[model samples]
Target: MQIDSTNICERLCNKSIRDISWLLNIPRSTVSGIITKWKQLGTTATQSPSGRPRHMTERGQRMLKRTVRRSRQLSAESIAKDLQTPCGLQNSTTTVRRELHGMGSHGREAASKLYITKCNALDAMV
Candidate 1:
């Protein structure tokens, strides 16, 4: 359930955290946290999470896509090795495989050719 900030402000602006908690049916700590966040940020919206950045940039992803499109049969290890060039990303085979899977291009074994019949050579001769 989404909380309407304006509704909460208008209803509980002058109220205690206990009152707000009782009125909203949420925990006192939650109400207090929300009030603290609003006071500091002037908004109740959640901020983007802080964490490690992605290894691949947009340019890197585009380059990877082009490389994959150019040769779908390339192994992930080969791709990783190619990516070690100055113009490409230096990544592990696992990273290449993960990126490929993320892009919806799964690795597949090449299918074998079907056995040829006598008529196949006859048709070719014709």
Candidate 2:
């Protein structure tokens, strides 16, 4: 169980914010802020941060994965083109490449295999 500064301040009873800061080895501003928050909001928990939303949704990601799996040879431009209609959104080739990279697909072509039978080797030697 971790004890927070709010609990420490509450336990101090009539102790000054500076006293709490000195005894707890915390900054006076931090001690004062915690006490102020407890008095105002009745809790010392931090609020969640608001940030920008994603450009692509979960469905868009799934569609991209399915398209890549269907044709490993497709370039990022072609994949982005295909995604536009089905996913109902437009993404740049760079974005598609980035998404593919994030999904652990390097978008590389399959390696070609060379066949060399015994007869072929003998013919090459001649």
Candidate 3:
């Protein structure tokens, strides 16, 4: 399903913007933009995004991971505190939560906490 550069060059090099738009089933504006970018940048590739960089370094991320792995039940506030004490990374709880999310670790209640009915039943039996 990939479009070959040589095939595109052969088919679309001489075609008008309207013709390219019709052939590609895309908007004329998009075609024009692509052509303009190609002419100016000499490539149709995406450029690097402009924005503020991440607050966490590789060492900080590793420390976060280690902290999380060491104590799965720890809260974001606690993790942030832990990171700030020994390490000089003054990240907020929200930032720790975000880093945890990026690492594929989502916020989840423990199994024992989730089964309130079971705990209630045991208490009633006692």
Reference-based lDDT, each prediction: 0.77, 0.79, 0.81
Clashes of 3: 0
Which has the greatest TM-score? 1
TM accuracy, model 3: 0.56
Ranking by TM-score: 1, 3, 2
lDDT of 3 by residue, 1-126 (tens): 122243246345687777767877777787777667767877777767889889899899999999999999999999999999897999999899999999999987756655559879899899
Q: Over 4 Å off in model 3, which ranges?
A: 1-12, 57-59, 75-78, 84-88, 101-126
Best candidate (score: lDDT): 3
* lDDT, candidate 1, 1-126, per-residue tens: 155483358346687778777877878888777777777887788767899887877787778888899988888888888777857577888877888899999977779997789999789899
**C-alpha lDDT of candidate 1 relative to the true structure:** 0.77
Candidate 2 on 11-56: residue-level lDDT in tens? 5688787777777787888777777777788777887777977677
- Evaluation by lDDT, superior candidate among 2 and 3: 3
- How are the candidates ranked when ordered by lDDT, highest leading? 3, 2, 1
